[model samples]
Target: MFSRAGSSAFRCCRALPPAVFRVSQPVQYRALSSAAADAAAAAAASPRHPARPTFFRRALSFTGGALLFTSLGLIMVLGPAYESAAAILSSPSDAESLSLFTPPDEDAQAKEDFINSHPLTLSLRSDPDFIESRPHMKIPPSWRKHNLTGGTLMGPGKVAVPPFSWSEKSGKNFVQITHVGTDLCGHMGIIHGGFLATMLDEGLARCCFPVLPFNIGMTAKLEINYKAPAMANQYLVLRATTIKVEGRKAWVEGHIETLPTEEGQEPVVLATASALYISPKQASVSIRR
Candidate 1:
């Protein structure tokens, strides 16, 4: 019975299958390796891209990111300058003539007619002080106020010298200048405030020029008061007088008025200014013609 039992146990053990163990990589790891190899091979086969961006591509690009950045840059660069230019060049209102759309010759004829009708007979040319200073009081050689090929600050693209005069009171000198601002404008129908300031600054310096020790003057400070709107394509007069001179500094007062060609309207005060001019003792600057 023992021999039989032992033989049966041996048979049972043989009947059971032997244990199996795996030595190869996992299925998931093998698949991952294969995919990585394929991707690297594909990348190597393709052409390389440029390292730098192109100008036209960047400027004209309509891509979402590109458009957004380009628009932001433009807005940052040109805000006030663009607004001022737009307002200056916009369509003319009723008060303005149709010369912007008219032919050049016709525009000239119209300007001639206006000037002839409202002649500057008593302008700067006829002023006693102006005649006296003609020999030494030269116009700044680089006074390039845009032309018909461009634009200007006076008399329909042609700046002419109007009445100029000077006086002395309590050892202070006073100067008066007259002009017709027919072309310079910021508002469509009215004059530009900046242009008015420009006129005042230049006139103030000029007033001090004749009296300055070196015949050279520079603006240290300028303050303006705009009492009324100065009109474009109309006659204007500016005057500045020296209030006092202490060492290198001088104080000046000036005012601008609109000169009406018609009989009913009196001259209107448009703006006023007070300015300080100074002469540097040691300077190495000179202007060229």
Candidate 2:
């Protein structure tokens, strides 16, 4: 029985399946770690982008951009304006005469008769202190070509006769009577304000030129106030009074008005102005020793 039992135990042990024993295998952890280290080194050696700009650098860039755009916009806006201004200021051309619409000879004659017979003209002629010479008429021929008022603006229908003027011998006051043609209108039937301003400048300058150092002066400043629209193709009067005079500078005020149709009638005020004139300094001579 013991033998049988021992044999039975042996058979049972043989019949049981073989037990599985787990064997430890070495892992490639070191290799994986080396590959990770190499990747880190490669990443560290690669170049990187720079940091953000400072506040001052950013502000400067913004300012430069703004100025560039602003200059371009100003050029677009001011370029045409400058051209128009230059055209107006330049001397009138021969083609500009068409704008005058010259009147018929008979009508021009009649107009001349009326102005010559005007009471204002007669009175100015009678004044001894006042000389009735045409302003700028006697300028050198070279300058006449470039003169706007005296050269180009003079004609039969236009400034009918040399402007009639009366002046005080003391250089304290001045008067000018002239006819402006219809062609010089800024708006229909209304004379241009710029034309009136030109007249005022000339009249006021004449009023103070005598008091200046060399009897000549340049306009320094002019301020004008328009009170009413001056009608075109009408006789107008410009009167100026000298306010004060210094060594080389003079101040004067003036006004433009219509010539009354009848004696003792009130003339309409068109515009008024005040101006400062400054005479150029005398040239200095240098003596070379």
Candidate 3:
């Protein structure tokens, strides 16, 4: 009867599942119970200490994003402001208009008194016998004359004189002119660029006049290249030539040279220039007369 019962128990144990048999063993059952308890403890602990970002980390992320956005916004707003400010600052100042002043006429008695006091006559046209009686032609009379006899070509504080003369009939159409003295210089001692440009323009115009037939020429374009600084009280001579002529246009080239102040001093090249001259609309105006 005992053997039959043992056989029956073994058959029942063989038919049961592996997991059920494993739990039936004391060592395996204790191990499974301990593992389930550890899992449950871990789940309870996770709920007590929930995952979250720290205050410092959150604050730093927010500040970084805000700074990035503010920088972009500032760039968008300040770019145009900087450009507008630069434009305003770079604009030229307005120039004033000229004023006309009339001088008082002297009577015959006053004229006689003036003539007696000042014996030397300053009239360039009247004194033909005098060596310096001729008008100061900045260029040779043969090349061309602008006829600035009755009109004042310069401001009240300015004075200019022609150094030489040339003839239109002669092939020597090119010439060198100069401007010096403290009155014409700017910035205490340096020659102003504007003044230098003006002189170049005039020289080019004078150069074209002799080349052209009859029409008065006007400056269409002038380009100056400043090679060296022009100093005050130094004689600066600008050499100009008529390079090419096409229809109503004349192309001229010029260069500025500082004359040697003392003996054996080397002449310095100050500036170079090129220009275009166009015939004026009023072609009948006599520049020679």
Candidate 4:
């Protein structure tokens, strides 16, 4: 009976102490609290990269901008169905019609001034031989009317002179001709240099024309040295001298000079020329038109 009492007492003591034990008021969660504190500290530190701009900030800022309609433009130009984005660029000119001022009387005055100033014209009044000078009888009007050029005969100008005048002294052959620059303008007021060159070429051949057998010659090569401007409407003087006549080739030297405006003033040298004229073959001389 004593042993049974002792066992009962031990069991009752264990059950009573377990019932008396209680959980303390809930302990704060360390994991959740530490995470929250770390997050707050990080927010307070300086940022490495700036945050993305908000829509409100973009709307308020009027700074340098991106092309907002960029996607729409790309869709229009590089689309499934192409649409050309090139702008039409064109303009009309009214420059000719809207000219502000009229040009001077360049043609008439130039012609008159050139003629009146020519020294050859003054000589014509004093020297009868100069006045008597005329084209050689050998050079027919048909030849002049069918004057030779690159390969064709040039027609008469708007104004024409009477005929070429020829005279000679020593070995030099002199030819006088007058031309109105208004009729042969390379530019508006200037006489064509090519026309002057053609005249010089003719002077070269005509210097030795009287000595040729067939009365026909063709220029092989001609070089000109331009010295001064040849004005329009001037009575120019061209003098050529035969340097030598070697069988079929005739070498000639010539000069073209402008008429001086005043007495004792040297004539303005316009150009110097040298040429080689060769007798044409009989076959080349036959008339073709």
Best by lDDT: 2
lDDT of 1 at 162: 28
| Each prediction's RMSD to truth | 15.1, 14.0, 20.0, 21.2
| Backbone clashes, each candidate | 4, 0, 8, 1
TM-score of 1: 0.47
Q: Which window of ten consecutive residues has the lowest lDDT sum in model 3?
A: 94-103
lDDT of each: 0.60, 0.78, 0.57, 0.59
lDDT, candidate 3, 125-147, per-residue tens = 14443222112322223222343
Q: List residue ranges in candidate 4 displaced over 4 A.
A: 1-159, 169-171, 283-289
lDDT of 4 by residue, 149-171 (tens): 41132223433333234545332
lDDT of each residue in 143-183, candidate 2, tens digit only: 55568887677666456555656667788989988888887
lDDT of 1 by residue, 80-153 (tens): 55764555445343223212223246554554455434534345334444422221122222222333211343
List where candidate 1 sits over 4 angstroms from the true fold: 1-183, 263-265, 283-289
Superior by TM-score: candidate 3 or candidate 4: 4
Q: Is candidate 2 or candidate 3 better by TM-score?
A: 2
- Give the TM-scores of the predictions, in the order they appear: 0.47, 0.59, 0.43, 0.47
What is the overall TM-score of model 4 with all chains considered together?
A: 0.47
lDDT rank, highest first? 2, 1, 4, 3
lDDT of 3 at 29: 75
